[model samples]
Target: MSDWSPLHDAAIHGRLLTLRNLINQGWPVNIITADHVSPLHEACLRGHLSCANVLLSHGAQVNGMTIDWRTPLYNACINGSQECVNLLLQYGATLHPESDLASPIHEAAKRGHVKCIESLAAYGADIDYYISHLGTPLYVACKNQQLDCAKKLLQLGASVDQGKGLDSPLHVVARLFSGELVHLLMDFGANAYAKNAEGKRPVELVPLGSPLFESFLEREGPPSLMQLCRLRIRKCFGIRQHHKICGLLIPEDLKHFILHL
Candidate 1:
C-alpha cells in the first residue's frame, strides 16, 4: 500500500492535523481509497468541512467521484450541508454531471435542501435536468412533498410539468394532496393542460372527490373553451380515431376536429 493512502483515511477519521501533515509531506491531496473514493469525497461525506478545505487548498478535485459514481458535490447535497455545498461550488465543483440514478440537484431537492438548491441553480445547474428514476429536481421535491423546495425550484424556472413517465411535478403534488404546491405550480404557469405519456392531465391524476381535486378545479377555474372543445372533439371522434380531413389523414382526430373548427 502507498504511504499517501493514509491521507484519505485521516480525512475520513477527521484527523485534520494528520491530514495536513500528510499534505505538507507531499502527499497528493486527492488520493483515492481502495474503493475509488477520493479524500475529498470522504471528507465531505463525513461533514469535515475544514478538512475538505484543506484538501481543496492542496489541489484535491472538489467534484471527485467515488467508485459508485457519486461526486463530493453529490455527498454534500445529499447530506444537506449548505456550507459545504457552497464551498464546493465556489471552488469549481460541477453541479451538473450525468450519473447513475440521480443528479446533485435531485439529491438536494429530495432532502429539501433549499440553500443547496438555490446555490446549484445560481451556479447554472440545469434546473430542468431529468434523472432516470427521480425525474426532475422539481418532480423529486414534489414526490417527497418538499413544498418549499418545490416552490423555490419553480421560482428558479424548474419546469413544473417535468417528468418522463406518466408523472409530472403537478401530478405528484396532486397525488400527495399538496394543495399549496398544486396552486403554486398552476400560478407559475405550469401547463394545466399538459398530458403525460398516458395522456393524463394533472387534474386527472388527482383522486376523484379529493380535496386536491376540488382545489384544482377552484383555483384554475373551469377548463377554457379550447379545452372543452378538445374534450368534445375527443368524445365525438374518439381518442384513437384517425380520419381524412382537408385531404390529409388526421393522425389524431381531436386535433383534426379542433383545426376544422
Candidate 2:
C-alpha cells in the first residue's frame, strides 16, 4: 500500500505527466499491481510508449513476470507493438524460456509482426522456442500463414522441425495446404521424412484429396527401412531422438531395436 501504486496504475493508463511526477518523486518504479503485473506490462499492452519509457528510465524491471508468469516483453510481443518491444529490449528485458504457454516470439510470429520478431531476436530471444499448441515460433508463423515472420525466424536460426508433436512445421503447413510454407520449411532442412508420434510422416498427414497430398506424394519419395525403424523406435519410447538414448540397443539391421526390457 505504497503511495506509488495509484501512480503506477496511472502509468499503465498512459497518464504521462502523472507518471513522470511519480517517477520524479522517487516512487517505486517496479511495483506490481494486485495481480502481480507490473505497470510496464500494461503500458506496453496499451502501446503507451512514453509511459513505458518513463518507467524504464525510473528503474523498472523490464522483464518482471506476472502471477501467471508472463513478462512485459511477452505482452508487448503479443500485441505486436514493435516500438514498445524495441523500447523494452533497449531497457534490458530478457526473454523467458518457452513454457507451456507460447513465448513472446511465438506471439509475434503468429501475429506476423516482422519488426517485433526481429526486435525480439536481436534482443536474444530464442527464435525456435517451442511452446504448447503453437509448437515453435516458426511453426506458429507457418500455421498462421505468416510467411514473412517464418522467414525471419528461419534467418534467426529457427528450426522448421523442432516440436514434440505429431507434426513438424512442414507437416502443419502441408496439412493447411500452404505451399509457400512447405517450400520454405523444406529449404530450411525440415525432415519431410520425419514422422510424428503417430508413425505418420509429414507427407502422410496431408489429406488424401488435397493439393498438398499430391505434392507430398510426389516429393516424399521413400524413406529407408532403417529410417522407418528409427522413427518407430522413437515413437514407441515416446521420446525424441535428440534426447539421450537409454537402455539397450541391438546390432542387427532389422533386429536393431531399443529394449526397455
The lDDT per prediction is 0.75, 0.72
True lDDT of residue 64, candidate 1 = 71
TM-score of each: 0.76, 0.73
- Give lDDT for model 2: 0.72
Model 1: which residue pairs collide?
none
**In candidate 2, what are the lDDT values of residues 85-155, reduced to their tens digit?**
99987877777643556378778888898999877776667676766666778778888999998877765
Candidate 2: which stretches are off by over 4 Å?
1-5, 25-27, 97-102, 132-134, 221-261
Residue-level lDDT of model 1, residues 98-125, one tens digit each, is 5645478888888899998888877888
